[model samples]
Target: MVSNLAGGRRPRSGVEPGTQLGALEAYAAQAHGYLTAGDDELSQLAGLLRPLILESWLRGVRAGIDPMDPGSERGLRGADLARYRDAHAIAPLLPLIDKLLVQDTARTGLIVVVADQFGRVLWIHGNPEQVAVATEMGVREGDDLSERRVGANAVGLVVRTGRAVWVHGPEHFLHRMHQLTGAAAPLHDPDGRLVGVLMLAGGGRVAKPEILALVKATATAAEMDLLLTAMRAVQPAPRDPAPVADGPLGLDVLGLGQPQLSKGGERIPLSQRHAEILLLLAEHGEGLGADHLALLLDDTDLDNGTIRAAMSRLRTVVGAALIGSRPYRLRAHIATDVEALRAALDSGDVESALQLYAGPVLPRSTAPGIVDLRDELRVRLRTAVLRSGDAAVLRRWTAGADGRDDAGAWVAYRATVDRDSTLYAQIEAKIRVLDRRLGADATRMQRSRS
Candidate 1:
C-alpha cells in the first residue's frame, strides 16, 4: 500500500490507513499552529518533527523570515546574471546536470534546482506546469535560498550541514512551502570542498527514501563530472609566471569586514593580516618584494622573516602555486570587489557601484595598509555617488548604515530632490538631527575656547 509521507512519519506495518492519515493530519496542524504562534520550543509539543527540522525552524524565526512569504531573495540578473553564469566553475557541468536530472524530473512532476554554495539558485528547470507552480511560489533563478532568507529547505540545509537532507511537507519551516517536498545533496569539488548543492523538489507524492537516494547518486555523478573538467582544464606552466587565464580566484573584501576568497566555488576564510597582504599583492600586479610588503604591513622594525612566515602560512590555505615568492605576487588572476566597484563608477554606473559596495572593506582593521585602502575605497565610492547628482542614488546611499550619518550626502539629497516629495521630509528630518548635533558641538567648542 502507498503510504503518506507528508509528516515525515513512515506508516507502521499493519496500521490502518484511515487512522494513520488522521494522526498525520492532526500532527501537521499542531506543528503549524505552534510555529505560527512563534513558539520555538518544540520539545514541549508532542508529535512534532525531528530535532534537526525543529532547529532549522527556530533559526529561520530568529532570522526574521515570514513563514507565509514564499518569495526568496533575488541576486544577479540581466548582463550581470549572464556574466556570473558564464564565469561560474560549475557552468560546464550544467548541461550534464540538465540531462541527468532536469529532463527526467520534469516528466515526473519534479523540479531541479541548482544553487551555488551561497544558496543563490542559478538554474530552475521542470515541466511547464510545475515550473509555473514553482514560480508562483517564488522559486526562480537568482533567488537566494540561504537559510537566513528562505528558511529551512533542501538547498539551504544541504549547504548549511554539508549533508543530504529530505524535507517533506510540514517539515519545511515556511508554512507556504508545506505543500512541497525536497531532497538535496551537497556537491563537493575534487578536494572535498563544497562547491554547490543539487536539489530535487516535488509535491507530497514524491517525498520518499528512494528519492533521497536518487539525489545522492545524481550529486555524485555531477561531482565526478566537475572533477574531470577541472583536471582537463589544468595545464603545466612556468613557475612564478603571470596567470594565463582569468581564473575564479575572486576576493570579496567589501561589507564582509574580513576578506573571503572564492576559489573553485569554495569560500576560503582568510585572516586579517593575510587579507591585507593578498589585497596588496593583487593591487600591485607587478609584485611586491618581501621588504616592500613588510613596509606596507607596518613591520619596518622587523625583518623579512616575519613577512616570509606570514606568506608561508597563507600559502597552505590558498595553495603554494598561487603565491609566487620571487617578488611576492599572486600567480592567479585575482578578481576583487573593489575592481568591480571602480569599473561601475568609471562607466558612469553610480547605481551599479552602490549595489556592488557591500560596505567598507575590513572595517575594523587598524593596520596602516588596510586603513589607507579602506578609506580610499569608501571615499571614492561615496564621492562618486554624491557627484552623480541623482536623487535616487543619494537617497539609497543615505539610507544605508555607512551613509546614514553622512551629513553631506543628506544635504546633497535634499538639494537635488524635489522639496515637496515625500522622501524630502525624511531627508529633512535627518538634516535637522545633524544640525542639532552640529549646534551642540559648536556650543562645546565655545566653552573649550574659554
Candidate 2:
C-alpha cells in the first residue's frame, strides 16, 4: 500500500519536444495471442482493437509499414492482433506520445509504455524516423509487453529488475525485439515495492542522455501518483491520549494516583462516617436500596431514624456539591448507574470514570461494610487500567487514590511505562518512606530480580 505522504511531491509526465532515443532504446515484443470464434465476435473484437490498430500504425514504421498510407497493412490474425490491440490500449497513458499522434502529423517518434498495474500498453509517441525504428520490434502503443507477457525487454526488464534500466536494440535478451532502444524506471508503492515501469522507446536518435533523466522523472511521478491514490484508500490508526490534566476527563486513573491534591485541586477530606458509607458502596458497585442500606445498620435501636439520618448525612457529604440534593444516596456516584461504570471499565474508558467517581464515594465516613466496598472498587479499577495497557492513566488514578503515596503502585507504573526492572528498588525505597511493610516487600522484589 502507499503512504499518505506521496501527493504533490511527484513530477509531471511529459516527453521533451526535440527528444530522441539513444543506445538505451530497447525493442521488447510481447506475444499477441487472440482467439477467434465467430465472424461477429471477431468483427466486434476488431472494433475494440481499432485503437490498437491505429497505435500500431503509429509505431509500425519500424516494422516496415507506412504510417500515412491507409492501404498499407500487416495481415495479423488471432494471436498477433491480440498482442497488438492490448499494447495500443495502454498507449494513451503516454500523454505526450498520444497527443503527438493525434495532433501533430510532422512529429515522427516512438514511445515506450507499460501497464499501470494490469499489464496493458501505457503509451506510445514519436516522430516518423523514431516510429519506423519502433515498428520493426513490435513496440506498439498498446502492447502488453510485460515481463510475464513476453520474456525480457526494456518494459519487462524494468519490472523484473524492479529498478531503472536501458536497453538498446540487440541488448534485448529476446531476439524477437532487436530493433529499438528504451530507457525505463520502475514505479513503486510507498513501501518501496515496484508496481510498474515507465519506458521511452525510439530507434532514430539512440542513447540520448537527457532521455534517461526524462524517463526517470516520469516514472517517479507516476509512482508518486499511484502511491497517493493507494494511500487515499486506506484508513488511519487511532490517536493516542493527550496529556493527563489537559484531557477531557481531567484525570486518568491508568497507573498511579496523583500524590498531591489541595483545596485548589478540589480535594475533599474523608470523614469516618463518609468513608464507611463509600467503602460499602464501592464494595457493592451494584445497587443497594435505602431499605437494604438500613438493614446493614442498627435500625431497631433508633426505629430506622438512625439509619435514615446516616443515609441523609452520607448524601449531604458525598453528592453534596455534585448532586446538590438530599436523598442523593450514598456511594451515589459509583453505586448508581453501575452499568455505565462497568461499560467504561470494559471499554478502557476508566480514566473518564475516575473523574466521575472523584471526591471519594462518602468522604470521612467509615463502617466495616464501607471499608470492604471501597477496597474492592479500588482494586477492580486498578486491575482494569493495568489490563488496558495504558499505565499513565492508571498512574493518574492511583495518584488520586489512597495509595497516592504507595510505592508499589508508583514502581509498577514506572515499570510498565519504561519496561524496566531496575526501578523496583527505587519503588521499594519510596514505599518504605510511606509504609514499612511495603518497603520490605519492595526490597524482596528487587532482590528477586537481582
- RMSD values for the candidates in order, in angstroms, are 20.3, 30.1
Q: Which candidate is the best by TM-score?
A: 1
lDDT of 2 by residue, 1-450 (tens): 211122322111122322322211211111121111222222221211122221232123223422122221222334433443344323333454334232342243545555443233444444656656555566654444544334445666554445565655543434556566667777666666454566676663535666667677766665566566668867753333322331111112222233121222455554454444443444333334443343233212123356567766755643343221122232223323233454677677777766555544333333323322344456566666555546667567556755475444565565565445655565545656644532343233332321
Residue 446 lDDT in model 2? Answer: 31
Q: Candidate 1: where is the Cα deviation over 4 Å?
A: 1-28, 39-47, 70-73, 237-450
TM-score for model 1? 0.51
Over 4 Å off, model 2: 1-108, 117-120, 127-136, 204-206, 230-450
**TM-score of each prediction:** 0.51, 0.30
- 10 residues in a row with least lDDT, candidate 1: 441-450
Error of 2 at 138 (Å): 2.3
Against the hidden true structure, what lDDT does model 2 obtain?
0.43
The 10-residue segment of model 2 with minimum total lDDT is 26-35
Cα lDDT listed for each candidate: 0.71, 0.43
